[model samples]
Each structure stands twice: as structure tokens, then as C-alpha cells.
Target: MDIWISKIGYYFLNVGIVLVYGLLLGAFIAKTMARVQGRIGIPIYQPFIDILKTFTKRQAISHGIMFNLGPAFRLAGGLGTLAFIPVIYGNEMFSNFSAAGDLLLVMYFIFFGQLGMALGSGESGHPYAAMGIGRGLAQMTAYEVPFTLAVVAIFIQYDTSSITEIVAAQQGSIWNWTLFTNPLAVIAAMIAFLGMAAYPPFDVAMAPNEIPIGPPTEFHSHFLSMMQMNRAIFAGAKLILFMNLFFGGATGLIELVFKTWAIYMVAILVGAAFPRFRTEQAVRFFLGVPMLIGIASVLYIQYWAQ
Candidate 1:
């Protein structure tokens, strides 16, 4: 009973940490982008203020139960994904619920909230929302091919689907990190990471000008606040996952922050330099070069690495 209680407490603690720092990191990204464009950016604390104001708003209309639950589902997904990954190597305090599941479970949970959000959007009876979800889902399918292949290559090379074990294998030297040892797989995965970050070139799902902020077009007030919080947490979670898999897991909080932030900046830099891709263009791009690289990575690992 005590063990179970500790696990639950740790889960919440991890979620809290992610929420706070994630928002700060997101605000930093926004500020950086603004500066690059030669403008004075909002304060680093702007996200917190926006979220608070959103929660305090008086008017909120719900299309139905799913519309009401959509944000909750998205938030849950972010937290669930965070809970499954060990945050700090060999640190009991920050390991969270990672012992309860492996990499495959974490992968499935990554999509759980997305499917829920899609269903809720569908129930909202908004054509734009549905169209955005469809495009997002199609793009997701395109990227997952390469992402999955890259993951499979890592699993085969390491002979474990347990994330903790994978991290352990990469220790002892910087050269042991997958980014150095399996460059092909890392390249494929990082390309997919760009899409997962959902910036320009892959952000048609939430194109503010084109679809008026699709998927959550009907969401406002507290619902919007929850979605904002989820975005922060989910973005941080993805950064951590990449850091663990390719950069070598962090040994301490400071290292964790540095590694994740550096990786996050890569996505931001790419997003700033590129323009949005139509859904079909994004799909074809991923399926072509990224997919081929992913397959070749697996083959190289299986044949040459052996």
C-alpha cells in the first residue's frame, strides 16, 4: 500500500514539475522567435498569465460532454506519457511511475490522448475541426512509419524495449550515446521529431489563419487553459524522450534541463526557417526520404552492426 501511494504521489510530482518548467521553456521559445524576427517579445512569464486569465474568464460554452472532456483527455495524455518515462537516471525521487511500464507502453500512451481529442472534436460537429483532425491524423500516419522503424532498430540493436535498459546501455562514455553510435537511426528519429513538435511545415492541424485554430475551434476559457497547459507538458515530455533515446539520459536535473532545452531549440530553429507544408506535401516528404532512411537504418543495424 505504501509503495502504491508513493507511486501515485510521484506521478503528480512529475506532472507538476513538467507543467512549471515546460511553460517556462515554451515561453522562452516564443521570446526567441520574436527576437529573431526583430520584435520585443512577451515576458517569459506570459504563458502563466495567459493561462490564469483564461481560467478566470466568465463565459464558457460546451457543445456536449465530449467537448467538455476534450481538454481533460489531452491533459491526461500528457501526464500519462510523462509518468511512463524515467526522468533521471538512477534517481529514485524523479523516476516516477517508469517501473510500471516499458517503452512500448509509453508509445501507446503517447497516442491515447490524441485519439480521445479526435473523438471529442468529432463530437463537436464542427467541419473545420474534423478536417484538421483528419489532416493531423494522416500526417501522423506518415511520420509514424519512419519513427516506428527507428524505434524498432534501436530495440533490435539493444535487445530491449525497456527504456531504462536502453539508457543504461548508452552510459560510460559520450561515444556510447545513440546519436554517435547509431547516427542513421538518430537522424531519422530527429526528422520525425520535427513533425511531432508541430511547428511550421507540419502545423496545418492548428493553422490559425487557415482554419481559425482548428481542432479546438470551439474551445475557450478553462478548456483553452487546460489545452495550453497540456501543450507545455507534452512538448517537454517529447524533448525528454528524445534526450533519453539519443542524447543519453540525464544524470541530474541540470543536465536534464540543458539537454532537453538544446533539443527543443533545434525544433524551434527549423520551425522559424521553414514555411507550412500542405498536409499532402508533408505526408509525401516524410514517406519518401525519412521513411527510406528509417528502413536503411534498421537494415544497417541488423547486418553491418552485427
Candidate 2:
């Protein structure tokens, strides 16, 4: 029972960490983008304030049970994904439920929330919602090609499917990180990271002007708040996954913050610099150069790295 309690505590603790840091980093991105465009940004606490206000909203409507349940599904997905990743490598307290799973499980859990959101949005019967889901799924498929190949390369190089084992292999030296050892895989994964982060050139899923808020077009009040919270948590979870897979996993909270924030900033920087891509254009771009790089990385690992 004590063991179970500890696991539950760690789970909530990690979720809290992701929520707080993710919003702060997200707010920082907004501020940085504002500066880039020659405008003073909102306060760093703006995202927190927005979330609070959303929760305080007194009125809401439901399209159906699924629409009402969509946010819950989305939030669950984010938390479940985070639960599988071993944070603060070598620390038992922060390992959460990672002992029960492996890299493959983590990859599959990444889609749980997305699939839930798709079902909920579809039930809303909004044309824009359906359109956004279509684009998002299509884009996901395009990027997953390179991302999957990169992951495969890592699995081949390490000969393990456990994330903890992979992290253990890279310890004691910065050069040991996959970023240096598997540059091609890193390049391919980082390209997919942009789309995963939902940045410009790949943000067709939420083209406000074109789709008027996309999948969550009809969500408001507390439901919107839940989505916002999930956004921050999911973003942080993605950063942690990349940090574990590419950068050496952090040994301390501070290291985790710095590494994850740096990784998150890459997405922000790319988003600020690029213009949006049409859905088809984005798909084609991922399938082109990035896919080729992924394939090359796998081949290099198989025949050359040995």
C-alpha cells in the first residue's frame, strides 16, 4: 500500500511540475514572440490568468456527453503520457509508473488523448471541427514517419525498448547523448518536433482565421480551461520525452527544467520564424527530406555504427 501511495504521489507531483513549468515556458514563448514582432508582450503570468478566468466562467453548453467528456479525455491523455516517462533519471521517487511500461508503451499512450479529442469533436457535428481533425491526423501521419524511424534507429543502436535503459547507457558523458551520436536521427526527430509542438508551418490544426478555433471551436468556459491546462501539460510532456530520448535525462529538477525549456524553445524559435503551411504542403514537406533523413539514420545505425 505504501508503494502504491508513493507512486500516486509521484504521479501527481510530476503532473503539477509539468503544469507549472509548461505554462511559464509557454508564456515566455509568447513574450519572446511579441518582442520579435516589436510589441510588448502580456505579463508572464498571462496564461495562468487566462486559465483561471476560463474556469471562473459561469455558463457552458454541451453538444452531448462526448463533447462534455472531450476535455476529460484530452487531459487524461496528457497525464497518461507523462506517467510512462521516467523523469529525473536514477531517482526512484520521480520514476512514477515508468517501471510498468517501456518506450513502445509511451509512444502508444501519446495518441490516447488525440484519439479521444477526435471522437469528442466529431460528435460535436461542427464542420470546422471535423476539418481540423482531418488536417491534424493527416499531419500527424506525415510526421510520425520520420519520428518512428528515428525512434527505431535509437532502439537498434541501444538494443533496448526500455527508456530507463536507454538513459542509463548515455550517462557520465554529454557526448554520449543521442543528439551527438545519432545526428541524423536527431535531425529527423527535431523536424517532427516542430509539428508535434503545433508551431507555424504546421499549425493548420488551429488556424484561427481559417477554422475559427478548429477542433475546440465550440468549447467554452471550464471545458476551454481544461483544454488550456492540457495544452501546457502535453507540451511539457513532449519536451521531457525528447530530453530523455536525445539529451541525457536530467539528474536533478534544475537540469530537467533547463534541458526541457531549451528543447521547448526550439519549437518556439521555429514557429516565430516560419509562416504557416497549407495542410498538403506540410504533409509533403515531412514526407520528403525528413523521411529521407530518418531512413538514412536507420541504415547508418544498422550497417555503419556497428
Best by lDDT: 2
Cα displacement (Å) at residue 293, model 2 = 1.0
lDDT of 2 by residue, 32-123 (tens): 87998899998999999999999999989789999988889999988888888888899987887775237887788677888889988989
Per-residue lDDT of 239 in model 1: 85
Native-to-model Cα distance after best TM-score fit, residue 173 in candidate 2, in Å = 0.8
Structural similarity to truth (TM-score) of each candidate: 0.97, 0.96
lDDT of 2 at 102: 76
**In order, what lDDT does every prediction score?**
0.88, 0.90
Error at 241, model 2, angstroms: 0.3
lDDT (Cα, tens digit) per residue for candidate 1, span 172-273: 999999998889999999999988998887899998987977898878899999999999889888888888888999999999999999998888789878
Model 1 global lDDT (CA atoms, 0 to 1): 0.88
